[model samples]
Target: MKIATILGTRPEIIKMAPIIDEISKRNIDQIVLHTGQHYDEEMSDTFFRDLDIRTPDYNIQVGSGTHGKQTGLMMKGIEKVLLDEKPDIVLVQGDTNAVLAGALVASKLHIAIGHVEAGLRSFDMTMPEEINRRAADVCSTMYFIPTAESAINLLAEGYSRKNLFITGNTVVDACFRHLKIAKKRGIKEKSLKELNIDKMDNILTLTMHRAENVDVKERVVGIIEALKELDDADIIFPIHPRTKNTLEKFGLFDELNNLEHVHIIKPLGYLDFLLLTSASTLILTDSGGLQEEAITLSVPSLTLRYNTERPETVTAGGNILVGSDREAIVSNARKILDNKNFADKMKNAINPYGQGDSAKLTVDAIEDYHARGLLDIVAPEDIMNSFKRKMKNIREDISVKDFERKENALVHMVFDGKNMQFPTDELNLNGMVINYDKRE
Candidate 1:
């Protein structure tokens, strides 16, 4: 059967690489679609080249726009591509606007939709990503859940239990693969050295892409200052396009333009980021996927964002929820730097997400689901159990919060560009409150 993979943005490209690679190895009929969420060549093209993955089957060139506009463009564009390719199923990774768009088009066209990294919920609907993921899950025919916990999440949401596969995370698979390849080829970590990092250095990596962090003056300033504080260690930053623009706008461009300590660089390709991350000491970011990835790799992370969907990462002690607190960023970082015991504990912790072969398991499950002719199925018990376990885990170790609607109010949590400041206990959401609840 023909499988179409949809992706946009750098993270999607990295996560989708393994799936794409596997499909090619099997000589399966695979088609790739680039949603062009961020059209910069550095971010998008570099990932494909760095991973040694093939050029996209089609580049839609959708570019960045308003959330609704971007999603709409992708939906319309992907529908046409699906009609042209007419694949058995359209596969998408993570919870980007592209995923939502591709899922929407495929669902409407009566084509099967497979969602990778399914069943993740931060329990915060305020995030566009959470909205995109939930919508995609509701529409998917097959779920490539990265962890057993993710499959349980689908079950509680009342999605089809049988279709959920406990695939090892493709990201981890890609991470290990790329690091090996990059090292074997002697693709020197020269850029890292350019930051004056020594061999076996403990690097703290940072990436900021979201508009919220870049949309304002103070927030942007706060981020640069935060980076400035990360001294005596290499702070390798792979900046996103919008983030690059924001940094330039705030006139901190020259300060970090080529600063000695803070290595301000453009986004790296798949293998580069993977190798860089694999060798790093700690990750400081607001990325959900990276948070899970850090856990699997056993690298301690200090989240730049206030909250996260993958509270399990924090509860397991591989991650810290700092939420843009300045004092917290510097202080906690020092604590982590000084504490050898904490580093060892988090490094060996279980990767609650998955073992890194989710694509294979998911494809097998999809074939089985189709063979059963049970396309119109939703399995609630499976997801409910997973959610319960996660909630139970959160309750035991972390503080849990529930949100109730304040009439006509838009909910938002402010982040001041601090490092791992907030306690993970604060992010242990007992459960999620979505616009609609679906069940089997």
Candidate 2:
């Protein structure tokens, strides 16, 4: 069977690397598609080179845009390639717009979708990632969950146990694999020299690029103020391009740059960053992948967010949630930096993600599922009929107004052999009536 892996951002590339490499080793036809969500050479191309990932088969340059525009463009681009290649299954990793678009397109075309890091929920609908992940999960045919907790989440959500496999996170696989390469290449010494750091001790690696934290000026100022307080530690911030643009927009780039201890460098390649992560005494960031990496590397981390989707790290005691509050950030950083016992406790916490063999497990699960005929695509008509039956059951409990509200909120689209059909007429609660209009 053929597999088409869709990835966009740098994190997706890093996490999907091991799985892609594994697919290459097996007797499977694999296609890699890049959405170019991260367009810069530093952010995108450098990572492929660092991880030794083969050049993507397709790169639709759907660069930065508003969420709607970006996702739409990705859907259009991905659908074209998928239709041309007609792969049996489409694999998507993280909850980026690319994942959402890839899953939606694959589902519409009746191709199986395998969500690699499925069943992650931050529960905050305001975060676009939460929505993207949930939507992708709904559209997925196979869920390759990372942890037991994630599996429980899927079970609670009524996902079939047969399709849910707790294949430990592939980030573990990528981390160990790339770190070995980095060590062999002496990346640690090279990175330290490049960053002008004489010692790796007391290093605080900072990375904050979440839209929630960086978009708000108040939050950005608060985080920077907290960083200013921690002058004792060397802050090696490989700044994300978006965060840099936002800082410069708010006139805080120069202020952050001028800070004595904070080193605002361009985004590092995966190997270099992995080396830095391994060497850091403490990490401060709002990234989900970094939280898992921190636990894997036995480093203490402070998550600068109100809540995280990767609560495993926090529960395992490897990471702490300090949010964007200046005091909380400062207090936590100091605790990890000054108190050796506390730092040791965090460093010695169990890595809940998994052992480094997750890629093997993930690929093995996929191959097994396919052999068992569990990855077959459900027909669109069957899917719609099933959805309609569920909606009919829901119609029994809700008021007519509530039903109408819910139905209107949904984009009622169905494929009709040659064209797509969207319901234009309002359906009453008594019975459903869908009027189709040809868009073309």
Candidate 3:
């Protein structure tokens, strides 16, 4: 089966690397498409190179712009490609404009859509990513939920159980795999040497690029003030280009430059950043990906955002919601520095994301669907309603609670041409496969 994997941002590239690698191993026909949402080589190309991802077959070159303008441009560009390629499935990850555009265009063109990292909601409509993710979920034929919580959220939203699969988050796969590669390559010592920093006992890492925190003068200044208060350890601040531009626009760049004990560096490549994060005493960021990454690395993190969709990290004590408040950020940093027991406790907490086999599970699900001729199913109104009815009957037969908790449960349903059968009681504990004897 032909698959079009669409991605734009660095996080999507990193998270999708494992799935792409798995697809290659299976000898599937795959096309990598880059939307160019993030145009900078440092932000985009470096990740693909470090991760050894295949070069994209098509690049839309839709760089930074207003949300409406960017999404509109991506839609136009992506639609053209979909018309030409006509792949069996278009796979997108996370909530970037590229994911939304790809899902929308694929849905309109009668192609199947798969949304990886699906069923995440911060419940804040004001955040553009929240809108993108919700819309993508609505358009997708298959929802690959990252966690059980995400699966519950999607089911609560009336999503069909047949379409929902609890494939764990791919970030765990990326972090675990890339960290091993970085260690073997001796990137840790190289990064420290290039940055002119010693291999210190304690290093505080900072990465803040979200517009909510950096675009406003007061917020940016407040975060700098908070970082200034963190004087007990060596602080490494990797300044994103957008954050640098915002700082300059706000006239706070000079103030940030004047701060001692803070080593302000340019944004790091994937390997260097991985090495730095793995060695950090504590991490402070507004990035959603970093929250999960810290959990995998066993590094304590202080989230600069007020709310996070990845609350499992917070529950695991691997992260704290400090927001942009100076006092809160400083206090949280101090807690990590002073309370070693608390830090150790957080480091040992369960990482709820998943093991590093997410990519394998995702690919296995895809292969299963393709081999069963389910990848051609379009998520039109009547078709979706039928799937929903099937799900409801299944729920009645076996409670949703039990189904979700059952580790060995097999979902059995058959589709032939445009027709489907929901024989809810056909298969028992013998693990028989649901046969689709007829196909058009």
Candidate 4:
């Protein structure tokens, strides 16, 4: 069966790389579609080369815009590609606008959708990613969830268990697969030399690009102030293009740049970034993916956000939500950086993501479900049976006399173009009467 994998942005590429490689190994027909949500070469093209991902078969180039405009353009572009490709299933990873657009178009076209990293909820209606995640999950036919907690989230939302597969997370697979390659290529050493950072120096990798944080001048200023307070560790800030623009706009770029400890660098390739994260003493970011990566690398992280979609990281004892409050951010960072016992405790926390075979499990589940004809958006046998039982309960709850007494009530009903008579007497009612007794 043919598959269309839709992805946009750096995180989606990093997470989907292993699954793409897996499909290639199995000789499956797969089409890679890029929406160009991240238009910058550093954010998009470099990931493909870094991860050894095949070049995208189609690039919509829908670039940055208002959320509505971006999603609309993506839907229009993705619709055209999906119609031309007409693949058996469309696969989308993460909660970018590309995922939402791909899922919507595929759902309308009656193509099965497989959602990777499904069942995430921040429960904050204000966050755009939360909306995208919920919408994508609603349109999906198959859910490749990352953890048991994610499965719980979906089950609570009334999704079918049959369609949910606990495939750990592909990020775990990507990190494990690439870290070895990064070391083999000596990317870590090269990155350290390029940044002029000695191996013995404490490194705090900072990444903040979420709109909620950077759009507000006060919040951005507060974060920069917190970075200033953390003078002991050298901060390696791989600045996103948008974040950099915002910093410049707010007139805080020079102030942050002048700080001796904060080293603001442009975005690095995925391999180089992976190496940097692996070597970091601590991580501070608002990125959900970085929360996962920090834990995977055994690095303690302070999330510069009020809430997180990846609460598992916090629960696993490797991350903390410090928000944009200057005081909170500084206190948390100092606690991790100054206390060796606390740092080691976080570094030794068990990785909750999985054993890095999630790609195999995900692809295998897709093939298994497809072969069993379970990928289509049709009711499964179990659901049909439950529906039948509910219908039977409704039928038994109504009395023939009560039905006959109603104005324009009928003694028969048509089902599947067949007329079926209602029970007219006690004998015909079978055992449906709730209180009927033979002695009476």
- Give the alpha carbon lDDT tens digit for every residue of 147-197 in model 2: 866776775576655577778888888888888888787654344557755
Task: Candidate 4: give its CA RMSD in angstroms.
Answer: 11.0
Clashes (N, CA, C under 3 Å) per candidate:
20, 0, 0, 0
TM-score of candidate 4 versus the correct structure, residues matched by position: 0.83
Instruction: Give the per-residue lDDT of model 1 (tens digit) for 287-384.
Output: 78788778877888888777777777877788988766777777777777778887787788787766767666666676676567645434446644
How high is the CA lDDT of each candidate model?
Answer: 0.72, 0.82, 0.80, 0.82
Candidate 3 lDDT at 261 equals 77
Which sequence of candidate numbers ranks them by lDDT, best first? Answer: 2, 4, 3, 1
Per-model TM against the reference:
0.77, 0.82, 0.84, 0.83
Spell out the clash pairs found in candidate 4: none
Candidate 3's TM-score reads 0.84
User: At residue 83, what lDDT does model 3 achieve?
Assistant: 88
lDDT of 3 by residue, 328-427 (tens): 9988788889999988988887888788888999889888888888888644464433322222223134432344345233343433234343323332
Model 1, poorest ten-residue lDDT window? 387-396
Per-residue lDDT, model 1, residue 349, is 79
All predictions: root-mean-square deviation over Cα? 9.8, 10.9, 7.1, 11.0
Model 2: colliding residue pairs? none
Give residue 135's error in model 2 in angstroms.
Answer: 0.6
Which consecutive 10 residues in model 4 have the weakest lDDT in total? 431-440
lDDT by residue (tens digit), candidate 4, 1-440: 99899988888888998999999999999999999988876556655776678989999999899999999999999999999988989999989899999999999998999999999889999988889999999999999988767776876575755577888889898899888878777654344458755464799999998989999999998998898899989999888888999989999999999999888887777777887888889999998998999998899999998888899888899999999999999988888888999999999888878889999999999899889977666644643323211112134434545533542232322122232322332223323422211110
Winning candidate number (TM-score): 3
